[model samples]
Target: MLQTIHDLYDELERHRVMLSFQGPLSTDLITALLGAVERKMEGLEPDQRTRRRVFNVVMECLQNLFHHNANLTIHEGTTRTTDLPHGVVMIAQADQGYQVLTGNFMAGADVERLKGHLDRINALPPDQLREFYRETLADGTYSNKGGGGLGMIDIARKSGGKLEYGFVPYDKDKAFFSLNVNVTN
Candidate 1:
């Protein structure tokens, strides 16, 4: 356990991580993290545009985790337990730019749906991506979770890059979804 913890710490340090969080992803927590990140970015980077881009991407990432994290309920006879919305996020800086990474547990069945969405977004060129973003926005459609389905598009637009994502099986019916977005400074 000690070695594993040390290895994780060393990896973050090597990546120049500035902030990280893992726990129940709530609106209040997101707001507080935004503030903290704002201050940190202000001190680290002088370019306001770059800071804005990084902040926007981070916000979208956290919001996705908040709205999409799976709630696992285990029941056996009269015993039951409800799991919280748990996720992890890390913000790191490198010579080229800032990277915002987030991970959360999700139903394994949803992997293909998410993969398809991400693949479509990533395959579009910048111009087409912008058009798609606008078209989706004007459609006025939203998921039951109150998301307009434009978050990923906006994140790609703001970050000026493709969204890198993957899924790792966490259990027979669950997987860990991870996403990474980069903002150039």
Candidate 2:
């Protein structure tokens, strides 16, 4: 058991990870993480703009996880279920600046809609993306779960890079979704 945790530590160190957490997330936990990450960035990140962009992207990602993640159930020989919004969040060093990566389980039903919307967002230039963000905000319609793609659009704008995402099938009813956002210096 110690060896396994040591291996995990080595991997994180190799990746230059500054912060990481994986478990069920709550509003209070998210609030605490935001404050802690902001302080961590202040100490390590010298440039004010880069720090703000990284912090903003992290906030948006955490909000999305909080609002959208589905509970995960694993069936190996016995059934194991994790209730609440179980997810992972990591902030790591990148060649240009920093990378904020988040992962969570989501309903299989949402995959297509989210994929298409993200594809469209990636296709647009900065000006078009900003306009699209405005349109989404002005539409004044929020999904039953909350958010009208505004958080994602805002993430893209603040990161100044295309959002990278992938889905791995977990079951017929759900999938593990991961998103990677880069905030360059």
Clashes of each: 0, 0
Q: Over 4 Å off in model 2, which ranges?
A: 3-5, 72-82
Per-residue CA lDDT of model 2 for 1-185, tens digit only, reads: 99999999999999999889999887899999999999999998999999999999999999898878767344565534455578999999998999999999999999999999899999999999999999999999988757777988999999899999999999999999999999999
For each candidate in the order shown, give its overall lDDT on alpha carbons: 0.87, 0.90
In angstroms, give how far residue 94 of model 2 lies from its true place.
0.6
Q: Which ranges of candidate 1 are over 4 A from the true structure?
A: 1-11, 72-82
* Residue 97 shift from truth in candidate 2, angstroms: 0.7
